[model samples]
Target: MKAFRQANHDLNSEPESAASILQSVKEQELQFEQLTRELEAERQSVANQLERCKLGSETAR
Candidate 1:
């Protein structure tokens, strides 16, 4: 029947749809990782600056 054929076609298309969704998820994960690394580096730089400021203040006192 035509309905059965349509159902079969839909079943076959499922894997391609799943693959596209999985690929998108992977790309988003990579972007998240890169953003996390950049944030960590920024935090470290800020911390270093604060420490330098503290040391400078202590020397002035």
Candidate 2:
């Protein structure tokens, strides 16, 4: 990709700045992954609760 090539060129020319940029990108990626996992867990929990409520209502009738 062109983005990767630019990053590579930057890393070659400005090692410290490139390293800082890479670290920031990594931190952002980790945060995004954590948020994604949390959202999935919450979604699964809500789905399970909804199923339980549906089953409970059916049993009452």
Candidate 3:
């Protein structure tokens, strides 16, 4: 396809474009990892709160 050839030509013409794309991908991956950690922390906090609530109800009874 003509579009594929044009894209290939563009990549071949600019080597730094590939490096720039690689850097962008690395940044996105780091951001994804950070978000995953934050989500896990939040989940743990919720679980702790639930366990405390259960303990409180049992003590009240």
Report clashes for each candidate as comma-separated counts: 0, 0, 0
Clashing pairs in 1: none
lDDT of 2 by residue, 1-61 (tens): 9999999998888566768999999999999999999999999999999999999999999
Error of 3 at 47 (Å): 0.4
TM-score of each: 0.74, 0.72, 0.73
Query: On a 0 to 100 scale, what is the lDDT of residue 52 in model 1?
Result: 100
Q: Compose the digit string of candidate 3's lDDT tens values, residues 1-61.
A: 9999999999888677768999999999999999999999999999999999999999999
Runs of candidate 2 with Cα error greater than 4 angstroms are 1-16
Cα RMSD (Å) per model? Answer: 4.9, 6.4, 2.9
Clashes of 3: 0
Candidate 1 lDDT over 1-61, as tens digits, reads 9999999998887656768999999999999999999999999999999999999999999
Each model's lDDT: 0.95, 0.95, 0.96
